[model samples]
Target: MSWSEACHLDRSLLSLEHFFSIPPDYAQTLTGGLTNRCWKIVTTDNKSFVWRPATHITKAFSISRFQEYQILSAIESSHLSPTAIHINDQGLLVDWIEGESLTDSLSFDSLLQTMIKIHDLDTQRLPLAPFNYTARVDHYWMLLSDEHKVPAFAEIYNRWRTAPNLADVGLSLCHFDLAGYNMVKTEQGNKVIDWEYAALADPRLDLTLSIDVMDEKPLEAVYRYCQLRGIEGVDDWVEGVLAWKPRATMMAMLWYLLAYQLWGDEQYLTQAEKLQQAFCS
Candidate 1:
């Protein structure tokens, strides 16, 4: 069953008997998700699952449910992410990882190791799609309104759109969002959620995004990642990540700008303005 039919704002569940043989006896809305609506469901049999319903803005944010399923399946044996139990046009259902959010508790070393493991995974057999940077950014830019499209934004877009895509090298399955908040420390281990932005891309891009989200220095993190992975010339890789830093920032700015236009959230606009100011200055 879809979100509209299965869930209600009154915290009541509808006919979920067909969705999961034994309808869930309990359901709770999980807040703090910026992109989609999420619910934690428990069936009479005591099985728990997290349900993320598809929305009109899923594509607007460059998320691919199909790719998410494939990536999860490819890495299921590694136990780095949740198991994708089921997916349809409506939404995705996965095993509920029972653990507290480890945003503050998770160490940088642990986070870096997780990134290494994900990069080392064998994804050759999976039909994973590459993250086309230009196309994706162009789509986001087009979604912005005229008033929001200032000359500064146009210049930033032109610079990044023409710059070389540093992420085209050393391709691997990269979790675009490796922030501590996206991870949960379970009894089994740290399990990462939100595979919507995951794709086959440069490992450096993953490292850059992770360090930036954690508010750590990019140069130091790059050096650590290179040392752990054992690369010959560390300087070159550092340069690549440094160059990708602004590009990553640009992508976030465009996304926030577009989100502001669609959702009319003042916070989103503020974030967009902050990024623009930082980039322009």
Candidate 2:
């Protein structure tokens, strides 16, 4: 289902009892996520909580709510994630993590250190499928014909299809979409949020994706992280990781094409053109 339809379904499913036994005194809207509606709830007792209604698309990509509860429960013990309070059949409630997003201002060393800490956490791996950006691009091309997204993307898509084997790379529990927007900078330290796409995958992919969205200084930190991980042949790995961007860009283009169809936004077409040019260049 579409995001709008999923949101309507969420609104229909939510009730006062879903979050708290008693009614909440105040509800504050939180933005950033494209998939779900997030709200900060303040109970009559002055306790703070976060309420998130899962989107239909996200439900396909993420672990079940119960599984998410278990995973978060284990990870929180290491103090890497926020504590999940309750997750019912309809929604989830967790501690409202307060902080700024690690957008442009976060230092490279700080980001790399934070990632290493998360990678070093000893939580048992949860049962989630690996994220294959190549496969996802192929699926998008199959599902939506060249008529949908820019046809030029297919060349980059094919180039990455036969890219070097990353199977020998190290695997760990990764926040699959660890971009600047998802990181929450707390007073104590950085706290990563949005566990929906969290899974066990090549740590290099996460590092690559994170650095792609960071400033030049953080790119250097990414190289440092690679060295500390004993990853030799930095040039080859950088090539492999950089190849991932075209595949990712293709995936984003598919989403925008679909969004444009629904919302009548020509800007989506404009963005897809830009990504297509970047992929080709």
Candidate 3:
């Protein structure tokens, strides 16, 4: 069912006979994410599942859905991800992971270590695309306007394009978006969710992105994390991380701008301006 239709179903008011025969009676509502609507449903049997109704735009949303399913299936056994229960011709449904987001509670040291472990995972058994940060950044730059944001974007983009390869830097699977909001602190440890933008790329890109989202002592956290991973010559890695900041910021700005245009919310535009300021500065 579409997300809107699912949200309108009330478990308390409606008899279980009206809807599709799932074991339990449930209620759903639009929750999480800025683009797609997610419905959280609890069955009468006490089983829970999340229903993500597909968004109309095929380029971003649809492609992301397909990519997420592919990546999750490829990495399901790494012990670092959520279980993708089922995806079919209709929609995507997965087990609802319950836990607190690691956004505020995560230490920089721990996060960096987690990232290293993630990047170090063996990928020979899985078929996935290679991560080319330079190419991805170029894609974002192409979408940017030449008048207001071109020069600033080009400056940062060039640095990442030609960044030197560091020792022990190996390309492996990467969770492109590893922000606190996407991480869940479960009983087993931290489980990463929201795999839409994952790729096989430089591990440093993940570190850089996470550093951008860190509110407390970002640089210190990054350095410590690098050290723990036995990553030598951290100064070079730091440069790479800094070089990646503008591209990441601009990409986010573009997303927010697009979201604003689609949803017609001035707040998105405001947030985009703020991101631009950060990028330019």
Judged by lDDT, which candidate is best? Answer: 1
Per-residue lDDT of 1-281 in model 2, one digit per residue for the tens? 33234335457235436445666666766787755567777767888777766555445333355666666877876676779988776667788878887866777667677777777776454555555655555554565545664447556556655434653555677776666677788887788787765666667667766776673433465578877766667765566566555555556666555555445669867876776677657
Top-TM-score structure, candidate number:
1
State residue 80's C-alpha deviation in candidate 1, in Å: 0.6
User: Across residues 1-281, which tens digit of lDDT does each residue of candidate 1 receive?
Assistant: 33443465522234333677655667777876777677888777888888776667787887777777877887899999999988776667788898989878888888998888888888796796677788888989988889988998888887886445453456888989887789998888888998888898777777888888888888888888878877767877788888878888898899889888878999999998898899867
Per-residue lDDT of model 3, residues 1-281, tens digit only: 43335545532222223444744455466445666666676776777766554455324432455566777777778768866766654445666788888867877667776787788777775566786555655554555455435564355456445444554456778887777777888888888877767787777677777877775455676578777877667877777666566666666666665556567789987887787677566
lDDT of 3 at 99: 83
Weakest ten-residue segment in model 2 by summed lDDT: 1-10
Question: What lDDT would candidate 1 get against the real structure?
Answer: 0.80
The global C-alpha lDDT for each of the candidates, from Candidate 1 onward, is 0.80, 0.64, 0.64
TM-score of 3: 0.78
Clashing residue pairs in candidate 3, if any?
24-44, 25-44, 131-200
lDDT accuracy of residue 173 in candidate 1:
89
